[model samples]
Target: MLSVRAYVPADEARWDAVVAQSRNGTFLHRRAYMDYHSHRYVDASLMVEDDGEPVAVLPANREGDSVASHAGLTYGGLVASRGLRAEATLEAFERIGEHYRGEGIRRFVYKPVPHVFHAAAAEEDLYALHRLGASLVRRDLSSVLSPRERPAMNTMRRRAIARARAAGVAMRVGTDMAPFHALLASVLERHGAVPTHSTAELTLLRSHFPGQIVLHEAHRGDELLAGVVVYDFGHTVHTQYLAASAAGRACGALSLLLAELVGGVYAQRPHFSFGISTEDEGRVLNPGLVAQKESFGARAVVHDRYEWVL
Candidate 1:
């Protein structure tokens, strides 16, 4: 029999240990990351144990009579070690469904990690979600580049990088998040919005996952021209935020930064994600944004979201 226990602060050590061994789990799923924003969500996270051994964990929170696989993070679902077989996944999800139903939770939103980010096989939960009749509710396309098979940068982008390098625009790992967040906010504000994570939140996360989350910026002496905040997920590194100033665009500083990142610093990683270029629950495509990412030789991979009536 499988049983679930509500997660609490004391469970951090145990929970993180499981996540560390989870095939599909990224640093985002760690207790340190989830608990950092605990005040924002009604924590209903769970630890699933079968025959007295932890089999899986869910970084979830309550929403009405429904439970979400963590709305606070980009992706979330059952996190389990590669040791679990498909049959075990199905049984485990059945237990999870039953537990939620018993607690009057009406539905569950499952966001499985995309295959591109996986360091090992981790799609068993997808099969179980199908068995539970989960419906696909959203799918965002992320642009990605594989360093070893990297396509030649188009002539324009190549020239931009060459020109910037020729003029001495430099890209380097950075410690400051304030200026970059302001740059990010300014960029998004032009389109009528703000950064998803405030500067404070970003600083807090960096403190928790120091090595996992890093900042890279393009500069000319004291001026901050462009920057990107990257999340390192072992085999793949994702660009969480990308922004450039008008000055940056004129001098092609951002193009230089990304070129160095995708071809230099992160060149050996299996994938370099350019993040999503979709909005409106993934129903609308931003052609211009997609083209910008594609200009760097990136291709698309679907990051899907699913829903179920518990």
Candidate 2:
């Protein structure tokens, strides 16, 4: 028999274990990462079981009559154990809907794990969502590069990297985040926006998962020129945040920083994601933002959102 239940403190070990063995799970799904901003959301996460053995976990939160797979993380959905088959996954989704309905939730907002983050083929949830008549409400496109079959970086970008090198830009992995966060804030200010995570929150998260979350900085002598906050998810390394100063942009400091990461640091990783370029729930595309990423030989990988009415 299969069943679903709300997650609790005692379920932490089981939840972490399920994520650790899940084909599409990243460290972001772990409780430690998900609960960092627990105060901001009413936690309604779920765990599904087959004969009392944990099979899947949904990192989610409840707001009003809707339960979102996650509002805190980039992407999430039914994170299934490696051995879970299509049939079992469908059943898991059924139980999840039933459980939420019992709690008076009228809708489910699901943001599925993008394919680029998968360790192996894991599209069971996508199939399950379709069967349940979930509508694709949103689609954000991310740029991804695969080491095994990467295309050549555009000549303009190549020249930019050369320019950065000639400017004596230096790249290094750093533990301090304050300097980088400051630069990131300044860059985002130009667009009338701010970072998703507060500096203090990012600092705490880095402390919680030091090796997995890293800050790559580019400097010119004593000046911080550019930086990219990276989230290392085993086979994939994602740029969670990125920014550059005016001088950095002129000198292509960010370009050189990416070259160092793509060519030297994480060359063996299966995927390197440049996050998203869409805004307003995917209705708007930032052409310039995406073009810059594509110049580095990255291609489209979509992050999708679905809505299911119970």
Each model's lDDT: 0.88, 0.92
- After aligning candidate 1 to the native by TM-score, how far in Å is the CA of 260 from where it should be? 0.5
Candidate that would win on lDDT: 2
Worst-scoring 10-residue span by lDDT in model 2: 143-152
lDDT string for model 1 (21-67, tens) is 88888999888788777888898888888776777789998879978
Residue 13's C-alpha lDDT in candidate 1? 82
Name the runs in model 1 displaced over 4 angstroms.
none
How close to the true structure is residue 139 of candidate 1, measured as C-alpha lDDT? 94
Prediction 2 TM-score vs. true = 0.98
Model 2 alpha-carbon drift over 4 Å, by segment: none
Clashes of 2: 0
Could you give candidate 2's per-residue lDDT for residues 101-196 as a string of tens digits?
999999999999998899889999999999999999999988999865656899999999999999999998887899999999998898999998
